[model samples]
Target chain A: MTQNLDLTDIQGNIVKAYGSSGFFKARYLFLRVDDGDKGRDFVGAITSKVTSANEKLKGDDALTVTTNMAFTYAGLQALELPTASLVGFPSDFVMGMSKRKDILGDDGPSDPKYWDKIWQEKVHIWISINGKTSDVVEERYQWILQQIKATGGVTLLRGHCGEDGNGNAVDDLPYQDASVLYEKDGVTPTAKEHFGYTDGIGDPVFDGQTNNAARVIGRGKLTRSGDWVPLATGEFILGHVDEAMEYPQTAPRPDLLSNNGTYMVYRKLHENVGTFNKFLDEQSKDYPGGKELLAAKFSGRWRDNGAPLVHTPDNESKAEWDKKFAAADDATQKRMLTDFTYNEDISGAKCPFSAHTRRINPRGSLEYGVKDAFHTPGALVDRRRILRRGLPYGKVKDETSDKGNHGIIFMALNADIKRQFEFVQQQWINYANDFKQGNDKEVLLGNHSSKDPGKVVLQVEPGSGKPPHFVNNIPRLVETRGGDYFFIPSIGALKLIAGGLVDPT
Target chain B: MSNIAGKAYAMNVITPIPWYKVWLNRLIFWAALKIPNVLNGLLTLSLIHYARWVIIPRDKFPRLDPSQPKEDLNYSYMLFFSNFNGSWDQYVDSFTFAIPSGLDLFWKMNVKYPKSVPLTPFHNYIQHNQIDTAHYYNAYPMAASNDVKSAKNVKKALIDFNAASSNKSPDEFLEDYNKLLNQLQNDFGEMRPTPIVSLAAQAVKERVMEEQRQSH
Candidate 1:
């Protein structure tokens, strides 16, 4: 039976976007609590201020104040909570990000000296504030800072800056001092990361959540006909039955403490935009279609219009692209945003299996060569889905300069960190055996180890008798600046912590 | 009353493996058997010898009983481990419903040592046990190879079981159970496990070849 989700008990940012129009300015404030009693008092003060999942703001110019918060394992320990209560939490979360650096393959950064300073500090609490305008965001930001200060907590990191004058980021921002602000391109009006691909597409739809748009287009080959089913809610929430049909091992609780809570993997990924552009410019010289087509092949989407390469193989004429969108109604257009699957492109002729999107999601293409391949193509990928809520950080100042902190503040929510997030990062993105292709890495997001220096091979299917596209000696495009695992607890859990009323028994 | 015969019998029994023949001859001769009686006595002795030397010993030390429930067994345990340098799904599927050669060696150890039941029952028991283990890991059993939906349905069943188990009262559990039944009917409509031909032996053979290559 589908369990009813208590939306009010969940954090707002987890279930839906607070800034609905994608035009709002946001800031992330990382904090460290010096006093346990004061931290509890601070939590008590902010419990009512934090937004609930029930309140979803809409409209292009709606000015609203929304604050969502999360805390690290250290943050909870700093609050004088019983250590026993933290048991059953994933080791990755308990150890925090710095200790799990080896497992994440973030042991060495591209600029190790620069990251050395970045890893010295740790953030205990993360408060995210989003408002329609910069003015509103600043107002709430200042208010949150004052609240943190009153509770004997100091701000560890404060980054606040909007998109560049050209609706992009300046390339030379410091990795630690700034939080890259994400906003839609003024001209295109679509949210894009530094790489210019349409961002925030293909988020998984979970049961009992109001957001169902992904269901229309994101259903894998597992679904038949009109039977659109959302993934089990437990995949993203604690105290709920997960895909495994059992409640994931969770932190100790009186049902109220852990229920509706979820774990957040907050990553600060610094993008090497300059190197990426240069690579594309040089590598595409001998290619058939040049840089634009090569970029599309890498991302699996056309940069300008976000048209999937699988659907539109070549860059369509502007008029033809307009006609395609014009023909679809509002609902159909919305569904078209994330609706396509790899069922027809099983051989990856249209979209290379190593493309960033194909590696991360795979959709229905993972069943090939696996036992019972025909029965359920989506089975392999279903357990690995994560609720992604991320935005680009830093600005690309000089597209030619490879020395910037511009990238994504990659955020993901999941019930099982190991099964969902880490599985995709390690097995699917980094490893090549599961795809039945040779040893390769994801073209865009994969961390190409310096030791092995993995290659990216795109198989452009037969009939032309052309050899596959091979790019050798690929450099690591993204660097882990710093990251930490956080627990976004329910409002009830927050109250319990704040009041010091949690019963250990 | 038979002092003379008892002394002769004691003396005959003192010989080693040959004492069996001497005892048999003495019994047959002492009974004053005719040709038919001698033939019947020899046949009976042969049958007794077979039962004592083979069947009783075999039954005394049976192989590991995989069918024995977890609660019943006091100390029987076995651990299986394998390292596959390839895909996890493929590796797990390779061992499904079939014992690999290495495992088969262990399975057949009882033939010489005589510790467990017959091969067929033990194999069947392991196969059934494998299905439960697969479900624990949220994987489909080999028998349901063609049924892709079985894994998802098993997950749903587990969810339902957990929900019912959480209920504090019989009424609540019944209510949850009824709701789960209705959900199964409505969501999946009707579900059944689709049996598929076992390719377990083939998978095991492939694994064995791969392992041999790795060793070299």
Candidate 2:
């Protein structure tokens, strides 16, 4: 990779998504600062321990546990940041997630009141402890608790692990735990979400971010020349030039504080597995090819193996794909998982146009039937990519009931929350005009509480002479439990906040 | 979407023009004002309640109070306001696709104005300078520009029909009514509260409701 970033300054989470890259277990802690001086002391103490985005760990150098921290607008204000620095921040970050619920398509059941009590209150500091195992996660969690206890300046906000299968009381826990789902054997881990679809497949690779330059194809912006090169660094990191050819708006004074930093969208999305399972079961009954095919249509991937429907259109071919993917080498398999595009199935005959994955990413599918719709293939999609993190929380006790707290602690890292995370949430997931799917909300993530909960159209296979399958009256599969926009600043920024050396002049 | 009132979206964009280059933009707007046909492409689109450009010279900025310091800005500002009937992207893409040269002519003099052909840059440029209206008001929150025009057309047609053939024989009046129906078919749509058909429509409905609530 050319143009290496100042890895020592950036947060390690931006460099690598800890959840996807081996850190299966994670603990998230929220804290409030009543006293600014003591808060600074706590920050100073954490700054030294906080992980930086250094080189990728290989073999023996791999970390068993990693720590990263971020602050909400309330958190920064609680830390007594200068007004200039605070005002210089973007309006969205200033408003925080609670105030911007309408902009985020969060209403009705996903309303702010429905959120966990921790989210209902003002959260200042967010501490994430990620590790290779549950024990390691607990160790780091205890260590952080010790830090909070020692500081005496910041109050540890009781977390709401409402979905944690441990039967923890709501808003009474010290921290929330998120872990990757275990296979049927309960030994091996899988990358599937509560909905049983493989999520977090193709996050964007920006310049100077990752060493694997080979991972650009279908992961990075699709170029007019058809080469899949890394996106501009500023798309994910501050101070660097972005896809818009402008440095991202940063806190002006003491530029070092804002430089090498990025914004994080922390959302606790609770998946209603019972409602989801029931919907699929009922829909698949009369579905032309039954449950498996219907499941693939709901998402754009085969449920059992996460094989993209664009790669394998039908059951017979999906069998072949499973074999090929199983036999392929590590590099080939990695490439195979995310390399497919919408160039083949432009008509949505294979993968439905309104499929959750297809609508979310599009993968240059906007140009399938409508030629010259975009200046470049996936030009609009490229700028909106977010570095996906977070893990599924709680345990699924009953497979049929919507109760009992199980969902994903969804985390998104990006340069601009409004341009990246909010745009994706509002336009792509909650609305369907961009995908030419009329007003259909995404089947999995759409806010479906209104009189008209949107529908999905599964385009029939070409030459089959069958009409398109219509999946109507889709329910809200996921809800916003609670979360907010956070700013994961650089190492230098933390020091500035700690020392109160943030001179806007 | 908050700028939306019924089917109309009020877009306000302010871009700085270098003092030296202000005359070129002045000449263009002036020429368009004189030759109204210069905006025929925009008129044909029929997507606006009102659209105007006001140029504020750098030194001419008002200082309302004595305590308010006099401004010392180097660049004059071009304020473009359009109350259009579509989403920002729809109106912009239509402008770029239908009248690229027209958009270029209007915005080319402004600083960092990208030519409208490649849309990403152009969209960003407008969005960067575009100001969201904190409070927007429309006389008719439920009527689009088309609705107003169609209503006017229907009224005029009805008056003329009444004046020309009101006292005709029954058979003759029936023939005249048929002719009138044939001619006025395009103006037959009834205006009502904007439907929640799309994302913007939903926003409009909410905004209208909010305005109605506040008024009460």
Instruction: List, residue by residue over A234-264, the lDDT tens digit for candidate 2.
Output: 8888988876566776444558778888898
True contacts kept of 2: 0.00
lDDT minimum window of 10 residues, candidate 2 chain A: A366-375
DockQ for all candidate structures vs. native: 0.02, 0.05
After superposition, the stretches of candidate 1 with alpha carbons farther than 4 Å from their true spots are A1-3, A59-63, A110-113, A116-118, A153-189, A211-215, A219-221, A224-228, A316-322, A369-375, A449-452, B1-82, B86-216
Candidate 2 backbone collisions, by pair: A75-A124, A163-A405
Model 1 lDDT, residue A18, Cα: 49
Taking the tens digit of each residue's C-alpha lDDT, what string does model 1 give over B174-208?
66655454333212211121111112433454587
Q: What is the interface RMSD of each candidate, in Å?
A: 25.3, 12.1
Could you give candidate 1's per-residue lDDT for residues A1-505 as a string of tens digits? 2557887889888887543445345667677778788888888877878988877477554338777778898888887777667674667788886665434556457332345343455567888877666677778777766776776544455332234446653333222223324444443333677877776666777777755444535642245342446777878898887654557665456667788999999877778888788878878987776688788888887786566767766556433655777798877666655677776576666777778778888775654523332224464566788888876656687888766457777889998776678767765676544464433667787777567565665665544434456666677778877677899999889999888777668
Q: How does each model score on TM-score?
A: 0.68, 0.78
Of the true interface contacts, each candidate retains a share of 0.00, 0.00
TM-score of 2: 0.78
What are the lDDT figures for the candidates, one per model? Answer: 0.59, 0.78
Name the top DockQ candidate.
2
